[model samples]
Every structure is written in C-alpha cells, then in structure tokens.
Target chain A: MQYIKIPLVLAAVLILVIVFRNRQRVELRAGSRVLVLALAAIAIVSIIDPDIPQAIANLLGVTRGTDLLLYLLIVVFVLTSLGLYFRLRDTDQHLRRLVRSLAIDDAIRKDGPPRSDADLGPDSQST
Target chain B: MESGPTRRNDDVWVIVPCYNEGPVVRGVLERVREHFPHVVAVDDGSRDNSASEIAAAGARLVQHPVNMGAGAAYQTGIEFALRDPEAQIFVTFDADGQHRVEDVMAMVDHLRKSDVDVLIGSRFLGTVDGMSMSRRALLRAAVVFERMTTGIALTDAHQGLRVFRRSFARVLDLKAHDMSWASEFLTRMSEHQTSYEEYPVHVLYTDYSRAKGQRSINSVNIGVDVLINKLLRGR
Candidate 1:
C-alpha cells in the first residue's frame, strides 16, 4: 500500500481545530453525532479506495487525490468555523435580550411600572 | 446629603454598571446620587452584595441573572432609563469610584448647552490620578488606534463617563457584549453622524481599580471581535 502524506497532514490539522467543539458542547451534541458518523463513513470510503478520489480529482483537473481532499478540507473547515461563530453570536444576542428583559421587568414591577403614556412615544431604538 | 452644589437635574438619569463591586460601589453611588436625583444601577450578576448596596444607596436596581459584560450592563441600564419620558439626558458612570460627579455635571452642562448629541469624558484631556506609566502608554496607544481605525478624533479610547441627550439615546443601539463595546459605541456615533464633544474629565486609578481593570492582552480579544463583527456586517 502506498503512503499518502498530504491528507493525513490536512486531516490532522482539521482534527486539531474542531475536536473541542465536537467533544464538550452539549448545545450541538445531537447534530455533531450525526456529523461524526457521516465524516467517519466518508473517511473510511476515501481510505478504502484512494482511486475513487483520484478519479474525481482528475475530473476536477487536480493532479493528486490528497491535494483535492486537502483543498476541500480547508474549505469545509473555514465554512464550519464561520457558520458556528455567527450562530454562537446570534445565540448570545438572544440570551442578552432575554436577560435584559427579565432584569428590566423585575425593576419595573417593584418600582411601579413606567407610565403607559410613554408606550406610544416615538422611540426609534425599539427597532 | 444635599450639601454640595448639586446639579440635581431630574431630567438626567445616571446609569451605573456595577459588577462585583460591592465594597466601593455604595460610596460611588452615594456621590453620584448627590448630584443626580435619578440613578439606575445594573448589577451584572455580581457574586458579592453589590445589588443590596445599590438598593441601600437608593438607586433603582436592575439585576442580571447571569454575568454579562459591562457593555451589556450599560445597555440594560440605558434601556431601563429610556422608559422615562421625562428623562431628557442620560449619563453613564463607572462603579469603580473612578468617575467624578463634577466631571459628569460639567459634561451634562456641556451637552445641554451645546448642540452636540453626546459628550464623552476624556482623561487625557483632563487628569488621570494614580495611573502607572505602562497603563498610560497602553491607553494612549488605544487612542491612536481608535483615531486610525474610526477617525473620530477621540482623546480617550475607553472611558465609562458619558452624557448624551435623550434624542441620541433613542436612536442608539449597542451590539458588543464586552470591552469591544467602546469601539462599537464610537462606530455608532460615527455611523449616525451624532454630534459629539470631548470633556476634560478626571479619572482616579486606585489600587482597587488596578486590580479590577482589564489586562492589556484583552485588547487582542477586542480587536478580533470588532474585526470579525465588521466583516459579518459586510462593511
């Protein structure tokens, strides 16, 4: 069996970047399990038949199967990071609104609710 | 309690963001309460007795259930204060006993007299007490960085003391949850074309504040957050 060096290196880097997210996050636990299974199957098939990747690489005008895998891996890694980053930010924003409303509601409840007249006032920040 | 030359403006609502500052916050609030009749303090999930201290100081207390950053605390306090239709001016103060009531009074006066939308307190333009050389250098670097990045011509990069008209606050929304909020505020001011002025304000750097202040390394995190956020906005 011939040694494939590049995909191993690419996979190693990919593993290092996203391993923590797959392990400790309960928020994404359900989705990650399915992702793990799918990735495992793809990795297995790619390892079992290197010629399949080579043929696809030839179709895509790539010289080596490992190089194509590396390119795809880099693209996937970046896309995953960007998607997760924005999702986490959105979740944070939602949590902030939740906590803020609870705090403000508690304050208003005890301190006599703000006069209802101001409710119809033109407050542009409400948007 | 009302002995000093109180600029007791009922139209002004002072917003204090209190985080784990149980010991020093009461004194700070007391000083602030002397000048301003209306005060809103948001305790950002303090582990200590800051909430009770704020209540004891007679400031309206808003408590976050969990620890949000100082920026979020300020936003919560501002939104709470904005509920009052009578409130015409809004002020942001630090809970670390740094900001002076006099500086706030001066800034509020400036905001009221001038046509500017917001008045930001600048220690470099005034006096910073007990600041170390290295911290001063870091802050100056931040000012330069702010000017280069946002071109707002600010003398100070991160200061808690600010006064803005109710009109400005009505159109203001802050997105950053942490130290990056200072930059977010600047960007918003520029984006909205909000007229602004810098007031010479005094900042006291005590041993307690030194312990509580952010580390220089945190600037790296703020830079990354702002950069990625700007990218996400496609600007």
Candidate 2:
C-alpha cells in the first residue's frame, strides 16, 4: 500500500507541475482551472483513503475502485488531449493570419495603388 | 453592399507567388510582362535573391518576413491587388514557368465572355507534356480527394493557374496558408456557390519544375489538412 501511495503521490505532483507550468501558455479558463484543482484534490484524497472511489464505484455499480479510477483517468486523458489539440490549432491559425496581414500590408505600401485599367487591360497586349 | 469605387474595367493583374525561384523567376516574369505588365510577385522569404530578381524585372514585389507558404503569398497578392479599384481581373500564375502565357490570355478571354466568376486551368483536360507516370497518377488521386471534399468535380484540382474576377475576389477569403490552399480554393468556390468554369491549359513539365514541385508524399498532408479544414470551417 505504501509503495502504491508513493507512485500515486508522485504522479499527482507531476500533473500539478505540468498544469502550473503550462497555465500561462494554455490560458486555461476559470472553469478549467477549478476543474483541474478539484481533480488534483480528488486524486490526493483517493490515494490516501483508497475507499472514496470504491464507495463511488459501488453507487455507480462498478466492481472495483481501481477500475473506476482507471476509467475516469482515461476520460480525463482524452479530454485534456483534445483541449490541447484545439489550442494548438487556434494558435496556428492566429499566427498565420498575422503573417498574412503583414505581407499584404507590405505589398500595399510598396505598390501604393493598383495600375490603371487601360494600362492593364487585355487590349494593351496580344498573345 | 451598394456599388462604390471598388468597380472598374477588366484589368488583369497576374499574382505570382514565388518561393526561391531565383534561377527561373526572371524569365517567367519577363514572359508574363510581355502580355501583362501588371504583375504582383509575392516572395515567400526566399534565402536567395528572388526578391531582387522580381524587382529587377520591373514587377511589383512583396516580401514575407518568413516562408509562410504559397497560399499565404497568394492571399497577400490578392489583397494587394484588391486595393486598386481598377484591378477588375486577377490571374494566378505559377512562378515556375510551367504555365504558358497563352493559357492566361485564353482564360481571361473566356472568363470575360462567359458568365462564370472563376476560371480554372485544367491540365488533364488540355495537355501535360513530358509528365511522369507517377505524377500523373498522383494528380488523378488529387482529383478524387478534391471531389470528395469539395463536391466540385474538377479534372485538375491542383492546377496553380486560375482567373478570378473582381466580384469573386471580394468573396474569396482564403484561410489555408500552405500548399493545401489549392484544395481549399475549390472548396471555397463550392461553398460560396460561386460560378466557375474549367478551361483547357497546357502545362510544360520540366526537370526544374519536377524537382521544385511538391513531393508526392506531401499529398497525404494536404488530404489531412483538407479534412481538418472541412470539419472545422464546415467548407
């Protein structure tokens, strides 16, 4: 039990460290911050007592406490991965737009205005 | 939106998005200039003197701070061209010289006479000289993927040559900043319900173009990007 508790505590601290480290960059919303903190608390309590998940699992008709925790962890993992994926995509689009706008601005500054219609018209040259 | 100063006569501004085509860009611009002097070449942060070559050729040159990709460069050129009220017609020509000057003239003539808002150059419909078998198959596969994604049946879905009118330019808001934008352009045309026509255009496959072109495996990335863009943007 002590051996199990050691690894569980280490995992929780590692998750907290990661979340904190990336909190600024990820721009986690208020709700997400609260949810993460709550998840961390639950993880700590479950590691210490080892019965809370079992009780909850019993109410939910699950056979084992570990199984319930594992299932929950899987759900959390998927959700987190999806959240990060969306964030990365959003950042990529924002950056591309920035670069595009800069390029367009440069073109406008250099060219000033478009050429006259007669000058650029098809009548100007023949293939 | 009511009509304003944005309207003008049919003037063709050739938008050439170049990336490190230093060796051949000068000749390509010279040929294009012979027919259409109103050219805007967007240099996508080439390490070589591509920008200088474009400027020396007497065409308007736009430089990107970094290599954003061909799609972004196209958007920049389009936006720049849109600034001129007299710039009614916009032609997208490749800087690699694969596209002929005659094709652009034909497309512009067809576009003005026809009712379509956009004209796409089709290599399969016309002729692809000196094309490799593997490249031909890849382009065929691209057509399938494009039809599946955009629901617009095009013989050559990835051809860089196109003629877009003034009205179409206002509605054409391209978001793809990479090679995948070619596929996205078709999807946009379909999604916007813009009328388009595919015209036969001759494509000259050269050794330089073959080496400088998009790799075959990059087709997978384009496919995935198209899927993701369709799902996210619903286009």
TM-scores of the models, in the given order? Answer: 0.80, 0.81
By DockQ, the best candidate is 2
Please list the C-alpha lDDT of all candidates, in the order they appear: 0.82, 0.82
lDDT of 2 by residue, B174-212 (tens): 777789989978888987899999999999989999889
TM-score of candidate 2 to 2 decimals: 0.81
- Show model 1 residue runs off by greater than 4 Å: A1-50, A58-67, A114-127, B1-7
The candidate that achieves the highest lDDT relative to the unseen native structure: 2
Query: What is the DockQ for all candidates, taken in turn?
Result: 0.23, 0.26
Q: Candidate 2, fnat value?
A: 0.50
Q: Which ten residues in a row have the lowest lDDT in candidate 1 chain A?
A: A118-127
Candidate 2: which pairs clash? none
Global Cα RMSD, each model: 8.1, 8.8
Looking at candidate 2, what is the lDDT of residue B163?
A: 96
